[model samples]
Target: MIQSDTIHGIYGTEAAAPPKSQPMHLSMLPCDLKRHWGRCGITANFLATSTEIPSPAAASIISTVINEILENSVKYSAIDTKPIDVELSIRNNTVECEVKNWARLEDATIIDSYFKIIHDKDIEDLYFLQLEKTATDSNNASQIGLLGVMHDYPVTLGCRIQTTADPITPFQISVKAKIYLNEVTP
Candidate 1:
């Protein structure tokens, strides 16, 4: 079982508790991540308008991050009634994008394994390995999404799985990707 402490660490120190002044601002985009909804193309459109990320490269990175997470959410989600949640916010000069969705109980373990790659491996090695796999016609193409975000973009990635109150989907998967504004080209 994935521990709460591990999840907390993935979200960074600030996310451990809410700020005393104001809550973390979350703006939900119009796009539905549960369905393909036109792949990255459509998601990028909404993501572009969601925040003034300033850097064009940063905007592209944010869009790609969202696209990858949304794809995973839709592919893994067990319940369609529960809408996939996408939140974009700016905190302490960093742009944070979070995507939440429900996954089957049995499939929840995948989150832990994915994060293992994040904590254990070097991003560059993983990226090249994934590229090599793709070149070899490997069936596990979906695994590269997170790796691409970590290797190609200047962002930090995190994920966690928790039990929700909903009986239909008692487990929820939340993935977060954060990029510093200063890292992006203005």
Candidate 2:
């Protein structure tokens, strides 16, 4: 488990410090969620015991969301020998998970379409409908896992895909998500 104090110290020395008034959390990328569930379980227990929050649901949601985000990074973004970067933080009753990869942007159209479809209607209904469509459609290659996250979790989810220009590599993609806990329920 990464502590808030350590995160504060690391970001403090940088040129521009991140906002520090909010509660935050952090974790390093694990080998795999199955292999590290034990660690997550312990972390959840500690957080539940230490915080004023009564429910352990937030911790469970964080673990699952991070696992899915990391899995996506490993499967989609780790293409050119670049290590996946995962960061978790909380601010103003919200939890943010960000994953960065050193891969060129691919199929931006498909990603845009996915977002469009997801945004057009209620997330829960859209997610279930998409799952059914994916199961029935033979031509669909897009992963349904993301929709699953939206369906299973009540938190408002946002995704951003960013591109950067580097002299040598030319491009890199960053995927970020912020899950608000205040609206999520156990």
Candidate 3:
């Protein structure tokens, strides 16, 4: 059986400070992963309208980050039995986005590596360059997608992954990212 604790953590707490500006909420069937992309676009629009900073660059980065994380959930998560959950919130000038899904224990290691690469500032650029050089390599496409997001949003890209496993249990992967609008574009 799959544990539900991880899901609870992702959606559990209410924000300490509600967004001074309007909040946007979106949810859809994970059957069409394209809806995830659409949600990202909506997030970008929210960021652009709410923040004082010019949003062209920030919007692009935000959209890419959301899509990359959502795409991972859609691709690696168990189908039918488990649907991906994504939530986005902007509060106190920071945007927090999380995506969670069910998986096997072994998959947690892969999720760890993804976070390590995404959070490493020095290596992220090099990693992206390598990915670009090998863009035609199908096997590495997913890694490239992640690298692209890290490269574009290096300053405000903070990511975390949590997992738990036990006998006869399904593992869970939850990815969270926070982007500080003031720090990124100011």
Candidate 4:
């Protein structure tokens, strides 16, 4: 089924964007911490231009968003050797960005629950609540980038967190951002 907007599912369900028969840009970034950050911009630039988004502003917006996603993928990746998979595709009036990475089961549970709490209606409320939670956390970390992406941008978010029965096996997190083409163009 072609999902219209929000996508959230655990195992045994298709919790991803409608498959892109042929993605415009597909990249596999090996978990090279030193190099991954620099490569995100280069790849995002290619995605914006090669995808031919038309409006310069929209292109810039899309590129920035993709770069952010890439950065998050690098941060959350569980294993050093596993590669992060990113796909860019155009579907009807939306441009979709999907990033898949391996995550520790603990991290997967937290992120999955976070997604579940955010529905179409109360995202703003949850956004601020999350802000406080992250701020007070022991790591002194922040995930506001994602909350801002979900709140500030004209995009629909989807996620599929694939789990395994074996406790030793790492889980997979697939995050998708679907930006409406029409909302983006001025």
Candidate 5:
């Protein structure tokens, strides 16, 4: 599970000095997005071995993040129509996870608008605001996934949109999340 190796360079052990420089990658699909939750387990295990998420507590946090992202992917993707892509990798002490799925054009636009707010102010501030709203009205829990990642973990969230060639339903969205492996708060 821990896929790492030591490689020496002419500079003498420089290339093999630190584990942070060697990143592991894992790509899995939610074969049946509507019924499958294994993708989240796969992601959590991969993160546990590939990154510094060794503690049970740390693993649980990463699992929560992965679960939310994969859930969003499954929720937006056409049921049983396409495989939800989950990619996890680590590089320079930073762990990156990306969830990609095809979504209705209008849904993609709305998701994009939400991601856009992350850039306007401190995400922690926005997260707390959302938390307050959720406390007052349960419906506000709808947007807790990404905001929970920002507030509870040291992660930055981003989104990328690619319109498909098909004019009818043309949006494929990729949501990217990054967390520093050694910087986990708890």
Candidate 6:
């Protein structure tokens, strides 16, 4: 069983989203991840309009980050029936996005390791390394969504993998990315 302690961790420096942040929570089936991909942008736009410092540019960044996370969630999800839960918290200049879904034990472990490697290694080096790997390997497609967002944006990412004793649904993976809202007027 994956230990409760080992399975949970914050990838970047910040451990939690802002305490007084306003939030928007959403849930949808795994199949809807692609079908409703536009939700990412919708969510982002909501962020832009909701904040005092509204910026369409910030919305774009937030949208990209949200898509990557939702894409990853769909890729690793274990059950079709379970809903993918997403939460967005906006506090001042910070917007935090979290996506959660149930996954098979193996995928859960893989994502957990992915987060650890990002924390341990230089992200740029790993990004280049992953690019090379993706170019050469057909079977082992490198998961680049998470990596690309981390590389391209000024965002902090985190992951939590939980293992349950229940046989029906044994693992759950949650990923969060915190984006610093763009200050430029849009």
lDDT of each: 0.68, 0.52, 0.57, 0.71, 0.64, 0.75
Residue-level lDDT for 108 in candidate 3: 56
Clashing pairs in 1: none
Model 4 steric clash pairs: none
Candidate 4's C-alpha lDDT? 0.71
Q: Write candidate 2's Cα lDDT for 97-144 as tens digits.
A: 666554443533344456557656777788777677878888545476
- lDDT, candidate 3, 1-186, per-residue tens: 223442322234435777655544444445565434575456445544544434666666666677677777666665434566766767776777777776665565566555554455466566766776787566644466655555566434433344445443256677666666665663
Across residues 48-67, which tens digit of lDDT does each residue of candidate 4 receive?
Answer: 77875768888888887888
* Candidate No. with top TM-score: 6
Give the clash count for model 5: 0
**What is the TM-score of candidate 4?**
0.77
Report the C-alpha lDDT of model 6 over 3-116, residue by residue, as the tens digit.
663533354456464646557787888766556767655655664456554556777777778878877887788887888898877765677788988888788778878878
- Ranking according to TM-score, highest score first: 6, 1, 4, 5, 3, 2
TM-score of each: 0.79, 0.61, 0.63, 0.77, 0.72, 0.82
Q: What is the C-alpha RMSD, rounded to one decimal, of candidate 5? A: 9.6
Greater lDDT among 3 and 5 belongs to 5
Candidate 2: residue pairs that collide: none
lDDT of 1 at 88: 68
Off by more than 4 A, model 4: 1-21, 33-36, 132-140, 164-169
- The alpha-carbon lDDT assigned to residue 88 of candidate 2 equals 54
Per-residue lDDT, model 3, residue 131, is: 70
Where model 6 places Cα greater than 4 Å from the true spot, the runs are 7-21, 34-53, 182-186
Q: Number of the top candidate by lDDT?
A: 6
Please list the Cα RMSD from the true structure of every candidate, rounded to 1 decimal place: 3.8, 8.9, 5.6, 5.4, 9.6, 3.1
